[model samples]
Target: MIELSRVPDQEMWSISFGGDCANVAIYCARLGLETHFMSATGQDPYSASMRAFLTAEGVCDDLLLVHHDRLPGLYAIQTDASGERTFTYWRDSSAARGFHEVEGSAQALQNASEADVFYLSGITLSLFDRNYRAQIAELARSVRARGGHVAFDGNYRARGWADPAAAREAVASMAGHCSIALPTFDDERALHGDTHEDQAIRRWHDAGVDLVVLKVGAEGAVVSSKDGTAERVPIAQPRDAYDTTGAGDSFNAGFLSAYLAGATALEAAAAGNRLAGEVVMHPGAIIPAEAMPV
Candidate 1:
């Protein structure tokens, strides 16, 4: 997706590449992970630019398929004084909608099955129909069966689903296959009517997720494991947060980088908070690589 963002009272927008999973892949690559991103894009200039951007970021674009009939999605963002954002999208006919149906997708799936870790978000599930979503779930299951970690983020957007029930069903199905569940408290509240963070944590645990990190915005996350232990990891909010975009995506990257290197879950959450803090200090989903924390 091409993102156009404008700050409060601004007339001009800054164009950049941004999609939930794409942001994670870029950050993970920058964090020294060998990341591969799989998605469908158009044969347009923006699509070409996106592929270049991914390659430059050290993310493998071998699985990115080009669709001849559709264009990539476009979204515009507007941020308020608090750095919170609102988005308007033009994605009904995006090439990514053809992700599962595209040519070479089978080969891509076979390659993805060999990964050590598989990660996706609710937004990824929403792009496909029931059958395609099942395929995704099967892919996650296969990864887990091979002793790989399956990470999931329920990044729910109400507009992305046909209804609340549909969103709930899809998220629940995907949750069952995830080993590491990274769900935002607010999204859980919206999708599952979870009044408390514990409700969200318990739900994921019930779905057999091994680790659940419930992100609570500035207050940080609640780290829980299947062993029945839970802890609150707190973080200081960045005072100069210019935009809140990609906070969770960057957090995922940082957490995964640490956790995969054998950091404890609590330590990974701190790493996640550190990177997320840095991201909000900048303007877009991705900041300059030099701006990253060492």
Candidate 2:
């Protein structure tokens, strides 16, 4: 959501290294976690710049994929005078689509299996081929099998999936494999056509996830655990939003940052609200490092 696209009258232009996983990985690195980003980039100057930017953000480069023939994806944030944004993207033939290249596949998969917690999104899944998707899913299952957490976000972009049903099926299958599921209520409603937030939560719970965070935009969010416990935590304050692109992504980052540090679901959701609230006040998916709270 924080990437680049050409639009009239949005005159303010800036470049930031962004993606759902990148935003979360940046947040994790800033939060003092050992973070690794698994994705491919082009051999172009833009990709070189992206590598430098991510390094400066504290993300380890060891698993970051590099490809000679492709280019990084791009997106545009079309904002009204009021700062509300709608996006148009150009990622269809990007290098990210070939993410499971063997150069680092085994190592990256091993890292996923060994991480205390592994995070990914629907866009992340869309990058892989069908076989690669299965491979990634198996790595997530391996992480959980070893008593680690596997967190998933159903950040479905209609433009990314071949069809709504395919997105639903892929996301649903991935949900069944996750230990913690974080999904935006609107995305869930659109994808699964589940009328109520509870039904969406139930779908994941029934699939065996131990915890779920249902992000309901302005109404706040619901945090549910396997024991049938559900807690509604309100947003800390309302806002005249600057950008909503990565609100949910950063929310997951903050929530997982606290959770991995031993916070309760409610406490983590509160952390999520606090972070997302701040992110929407900024102009992009990623805010300045100095602006972050320690």
- Going through the candidates in order, what is the number of backbone clashes in each? 0, 1
Off by over 4 Å in 1: 7-10
* Model 2: residues with Cα > 4 Å off, grouped in runs: 5-12, 81-83
lDDT of candidate 1? Answer: 0.91
Query: Which 10-residue window in model 2 sums to the lowest lDDT?
Result: 1-10
Worst 10 residues of 1 by lDDT: 5-14
lDDT of 1 by residue, 1-294 (tens): 999987445677888899899999999999989999989999989999989989999999988988888999998876778888678889988999987778899889888988999999999998999998998898899999999999999999999999999999999999889999999999999998889998999999999999999889988889999997889989855456778889999999999999998899999999999999999888878989999998
Write model 2 residue lDDT over 1-294, tens digit each, in one string. Answer: 228733334556766668889999998888888998878888888899988888898999887888777788888776666656688888877777766653776787787688878889998887766777888889888988888889999888888888898887777678777999999988888888889989988888999899999999876789998887788999878777767878898889999999989898899898888888888877778888777755
Q: After superposition, how far is residue 236 of candidate 1 from its true place, in Å?
A: 4.2
Q: Per-candidate RMSD vs. true structure? A: 1.2, 2.0
Please give the distance, in angstroms, between residue 32's alpha carbon in candidate 2 and its true position after superposition.
1.4
